[model samples]
Each structure stands twice: as C-alpha cells, then as structure tokens.
Target: MTDHVDVLIVGAGLSGIGAAYRLQTMSKGKTYAILESRAAAGGTWDLFRYPGIRSDSDMYTLSFPFKPWTHANAIADGEDIRRYIHDTAHENKIDQHIRFGHRVTRASWSSDDAQWTVDASTDDGPVTITASFLYLCSGYYNYDQGYTPEFPGLEDFEGEVVHPQFWTDDVDYEGKEVVVIGSGATAVTLIPSMAGSTKHVTMLQRSPTYITALPQGDPIAGFLRKILPGGIAHRLTRIKNAAIAIGFYVFSQRFPQQASKFLIGRARKSLPADFDPKHLTPTYNPWDQRLCIVPNGDLFRTLRSGKASIVTDRIARFTKTGIDLESGEHLDADLVVTATGLQVVAFGQIAVEVDGRKIDSHETYVYKGMMFSGIPNFAWCVGYTNASWTLRADLTSQYVCRLINHMDARGYAFGMPDPAGASGDAAPLLNLQSGYVQRVAGILPQQGSSSPWTIRQNWFLDAWDNRRADLDEAMVWTRQREVARAG
Candidate 1:
C-alpha cells in the first residue's frame, strides 16, 4: 500500500505514449502513472515480432507530432506500428493511466523530501512508488535481449535458432532455409520479409549496409491527405518528411564522396544484371550505420527475383546444416536468424539513487539530451541518431513540457543539471557507430563541451536549442527547505 504520483511514467512505448500525452496535456494538476514493463503497448513496436517488423524511420518522421500518422504507409508494418500505439493509448484517456506489469525496479532521489521513490516490478509483488517527476520513457535498448554473438559452431546448429527479438507464433518460416545474420536495420528487414515465406532468404553480412529504395506510399502524403485538413495534412507531411530527412542527413555528412556514389548508383539501378551491385554497398559513410530502407524496391526485388540472397562474408562457424564462410563458403541453413543487434539497455535496467549515492550513468553529464548532470527531477528520451526517432521524440516531449511548466511557475522543488563544473567535452551520448552503439559505449551518458551540455543531433539544432531555451541557464532550482512549522 504505497503508491503516489505527480508524474512517474517509465515506458508505455513510443516514448511512453508520448510521455503520457505531454504529462496530461501540459502538467495540469499532475498525477501520472504509465509503468509498463510490457503487458503490451508497443515499445519497439511491441518488442518486434520479427519477419519484416518495419519502420526504420519514415512514419512521417516516425509519428507523434501530436498524432496524425493517418497511415498510407510511409513504411509502416509491425502491425501498423502496433495499431498506432493502441490508438494513441485509446484516444488520450491514455489507456487508463497504464500500469501493465509494472517493472521499474529502483529510483531513489530525496533532497530532504523533494520526492521520487519508485520500485515497481509486479505480478502482485514489490510495488512502492512515490513521485513528483521522474518520467523516463524507457527506450535506449535491451527489451529483454536481442544481441547474440557466440557462433563457433553454436552448439552445432542443425536448424531452428532465431532471435528477431524472440519472435514467436509457433515460429514457422514455411518452406524454411532462411539465414539472415545482420547488416543492420534488422538484416534489411529480414531479407525482404523472409523472402516471401522462406525457402530462400540469405543475407549473411559482415559489412555493407547503405541500401535505399523508399516510396512505400506517400505521393506527397497521399496528395495532402486528399485535400488538406487532417491537422493540415499532418503538418504538410511533417514538413515534407522533415525536410527530406534533414536533406539526407546533411547530404550524407557533407558529401561523402558524392554520398557514396549516390548510394552505389542507387544499388546499381536496383540490382540484377548479374547481381553484384557491390553487395549493395557500405563501408561507413551514409549516416555511417543506418540506411537500409527498402519499401518499393523491396530488397532489390528480393535480389532480382532469385528469391533473395547477399553474402558479403565472415562467419566461419555454426555448421550442422548452415554457415561456415570464412572464405570456404557453405551456407545451407534451415533457419538461423541472429539479426545481430541491440542491447544498449540504458534505463529499463533501472537502479538510480542520489541521496544514497549510486548514480554513475557513466559518471553523469548529458543535459539537454534530456537531463542528467547531477540528476534531480529526472528525465530521459534520447532520439535521433541522424533523424526521425519521432523527430527527437517530438522535441523531447516539447522540452519536457517546458521543464514542467517552468517548475510550476518558479516555486520549484528540484530541477538539476548545473554543469557549472563542466568537463565532458562532448561526443559519446550516441554519435552512433552502432554495434549496439559500440556495445554500450562505456555505460552511456557524457555529452558536453558546449551548449546546454551538448547533444544536438540536429532537428534544426534541436529546434533552436531545445525549443527556445532559457529556463534559467543550465537549470538548478530547488526549494523544499521549510520545516519549522511544528511550533
């Protein structure tokens, strides 16, 4: 019997249902909930259900500029983005303040009663909670494992061994044969959705990622949603697909050899002609580690209709029926999918303290990338490693509802991030080199050496520095210091 809130939220998916619709439409009378350790509510589109689980950014900037992704496929899938996050948490009732299987696991913070207790993890077990701000939107990876790399004869394979994040449904790749190792974006979206029900889908990969095709419906956002209106045709198709994904990530980082020869001459005019389009290109450069999207060319028409395939090389093991190519080549497979990625578990692994110490999120720093420094009222979002992670999660939920309405109009209670003693010379809080962000870049957090603790993966410089800054430079606020009223 210990539950309270003014804002708790920790992951109801898609940035915890858009941070509970911006803390119930801008902090009015507070009182939040949203625990969700998955009983459902599409976090990673309901923890990816394998075979073509889509959206590698392109649901018009990955949705949530206050909804309006009236789908017409701008590369959707994953059950229509988990039924548009269960219809945006049941049309804003926010699905009765969520709670699904709880699971927070720890969060102390005190400052002599400035609140925040938390503990979660439930099936009718450990509960305790208390809050006054702590929203994390649990995302930066590890939704119960999905990065497996052991293969030295992986227990002599002999078929069936998948891991598209534990995909089930009595796992059946129909005619089977599959292979799919990883080149990123879930092995080019499971080699064209498991090459039309398997019997042939290879992929393998050791290097080479940049592939592109796009156009899974969006003729100018379906002709401005049939003559404008639906929120101005979703804000002019989210500002023309966020200015064409920020002009193709600043023209492939300022023209990397003419953007890798215009993405290997558009994958050699969409493959076939003896295949070879240099194994669909990539050796870094082109968002350096993410650029797969295959909407219309559908993985070069499943590798020019030979069903599907693409080797690249480097495996040397796991062979009871499949894989062995350290240049001897084997590849037989009945099923082996280890779309090799993801495991950067930043926050869902909870545990944070403060009064009792234990904070060390890589010796804390990150601020505008959504609060951290010395952590106080707390906040967490982390989106955009080039573009469209809900376009910096809708500007970090509108700058965390303008820093909780400017700490309740200045009466304050806690706020943090006073990096006055700064010393993290920026560049680490995910500048993506991906292999699950360089295997947990020394336990995350640390981006400074400039503006509001630096981390601008540009959404127009985080909308002119986190939606027009100036909430008392680098914040600090306090005020729970009055206790002599017992006279």
Candidate 2:
C-alpha cells in the first residue's frame, strides 16, 4: 500500500500555506500534503532569530490576500509574521496536512504512471509518497547554513564571532563593542536594534549600499481600517503599497541619476551634518541591488546619537582583538557579526528527475515565471525581488490552482512547457546583479526573452497578465491513456 495525494507541497512557510489555501478553495476536492523540513512552520520567519528581524516589505503586501493583517504596524516583526502564518494554517486546517521533519530529497516523475514518486527522510524513517502534481515552495536559499566568506586570519580574532542567520540568545552583545560586516539589510537592522544596549556598534562594509527610511505604520491603512471593513481595507492598502513600490522601481530604472540623487539626498538629511558624504555614496545606480530599508529612520537616528557608526573599507585581515582594514585602520571589537548574505539554491536542492533522467536546471527555461521547460506537472513558487514577496506569491498560487483545474477539465494527466514553442534568447532567471544571485547564476534556470517566459518584477503587470494568461501557450499536454499506450 502506498500513500498518495493529488498535490504535494514541499514547504510550510508563507508561500506553502498560501498555496494550500488556494488549492483548497480554487481547486476543490484536491487532496494534498505539505512536507516541512523543519520541526516547525513559518520557514524564514522561524529560522531567522536575530535581533530586529522584520520584513523589508510592508505587511499589507507581505501577508496573504485571503487573510487580512490586523496589526497597526505596516512593517512587522518576525514573530508577528510567524504568528500570522501559523494562524492562517490553523484557521484553514492546513496545519493538519503538514508533516514536520520530513525533508524531501528527490522527486521522480513517470509519464507512464502520470505521477511523481517523492522520497523524504524523517526522524522516524524514510517516507515515500506519490502525487499527481508537485509544488515546490521551499524557498531559494540554503537553509543548512548561510554564506560566510573566508576572512583572512578569522581564527586569530579573540572576540565572539556570529552570523545573523544563526543568532542565539546566549551570544550577548550588551555593553560590548560590536563590528558588523556587510552593509545589507541584516547589518542595518542589527546596528539599530543592538546599538542602544551595546557600548558601541559599527557597520563595516566593503562598499556602500543604497539605504532609505520608511514609516513603520501606514497612516492611510489605519484610517481605512477605521472606516471600511477589514477585507476591503486590506485589499486597498495592498494595492496602494504595491503600486508605490512598482512605481519607485520603474522611476529608478528609467532615471538612474535623478533617483540616485534623491536617495542620497534623503539619507544626507537624515544623518548628522558632519557625517562624510562619501560613506553614503554607492558606486552603482539605484536598483542595481536591493535597497536597504530602516523603519522610522532608526539606523540614521542611531548614527546621529553616537551610539552607532558606519565604516566603508576592505578587510585586510582579522587581528587578535578586531579587524585590520586595508586603509591602515584597526577597529577594536568585542564581537564580530558576519552579515554577508544568503546562499541561493534552486528547488531547495531537491534532486528532480523525469523518466529516470535527472533535471539540469541550468539548461531549462522558466515558463511563465513559474514552470520549467520540459517539466511535467510541476511548478516552483518564487516571489518578487523588487516588491513584497507575497504579492507575486499569491498570484503564483492562484495560477497553479488555475492550471490544475484546466488540466482536470481537459482530462489531461500531465502538462509540460516546451521550449521550442517560445521564441527568444535565454536570460538569467533572476535579473538582479546582487552578489548572492551572481554567485549562482550559472546553476539557476534561464528565462525566455518574451512574455510568459520572462520573470517580470512588476507586481501590477504580473497581476494583470496572470489573470489573462493563455493556459495552452507553449505547453504540451498528454492524457494518462496516451502515456500508457506509448509506454
């Protein structure tokens, strides 16, 4: 006897939970099971325990469309986000379908059987299950460990060293000199949150990144919630915030020089007069990499108050007490935090095979920003890099449900994207030039140069396009009897 489901989701995070809800509502009577690698849900929100862990995007867009975010703050903390995910799961009874500690290692699709044979390792033993369709919502990063560069003479440092991904309660920084490496979101967040308690906090970056400030709470949302219904207010706010984000991204891309001036000018106003303008300047234009957001100008406030500071220089090596910079400056620190970046991986590093042939993701093209070329009955849930992740994630989930329903209506057993059906040169799946993305560009999948195949970062355009997308475009469908007869 073998356990089976109509659909199998690989994660229990925001995307997975949302996908489950969509499947249940849009594709009714579809039996599904969620496999979570960790003991708990909330994926990224649960894994990252560092101080000041909060969403870079507004909660209105970050949250699921089915569930309204009732919190007053638009920029929510990690714990709140985790609680929201759990509540969504419990409310929809989706939690009942999740199998914790079940890490999926491989999925093999058989055209003859018209199903996927999935294998997973668990605390109890190896578990095997079969599904008609597979939805991968496991996220893009390496969860086993975060990326930490090999610093010269790291062992020589006498101070406590830590990575934001692995922050623990026992690693105290109270009244201690802290040096945080990398000027990304984690570094900006850690500096402001830890500066007040620590004796001094310093952000050490190899180069500057574009940083900006946003209000923690949305005044318009607060006003709307007071007047309109919860659902209506949430939808309006989500749309408004999403549009603003898309507009800004477009503005930055269309007018780089003006956007750069605007960003730097805003930062200068927030900082002290004597602060060096050079430290705030970045070599690249705006939107070249993701922008760092500090809620309520907290990072700038910390800098102005003399509680925290920023140092831009290349690291020569780690000394006995602290770091020796290439600029002949030695910064003393009692603790060092490597806020380098995340290690990007495709499909949670799961080994996927079709007809006993392993999938080479690098050789495949992304179909409609979700499905892969030549892959049958599969979809990967990836979010936007420019806007809130859920904005795109919700659309992806809905689109999957639509696809499933379409297949059932036509009595199709499986559908695969055919690369020959689309005409365009191949491009990187992700358009960003960030270090983490560039590091794994060669390993990730490619996108076609035209619509349906291109992964657009604009949420507004995606929402409009997804609703009117042609389900039959560039897709090859087959019936179960046909597969069996061919075999």
Per-candidate clashes, comma-separated: 2, 0
Give one digit per residue, the lDDT tens place, for model 2 in 143-205.
988889999999999999999999999989999999999998999999999998999999999
Off by over 4 Å in 2: 419-424
The weakest ten consecutive residues by lDDT in model 1 span 478-487
- Which pairs clash in model 2? none
Give residue 215's lDDT in candidate 1 (0 to 100): 84
Error of 1 at 107 (Å): 12
Backbone clashes (count) for model 2:
0
Each prediction's Cα lDDT score? 0.81, 0.93
**Per-residue error at 15 for model 2, in Å?**
0.3
For model 2, the local distance difference test gives: 0.93
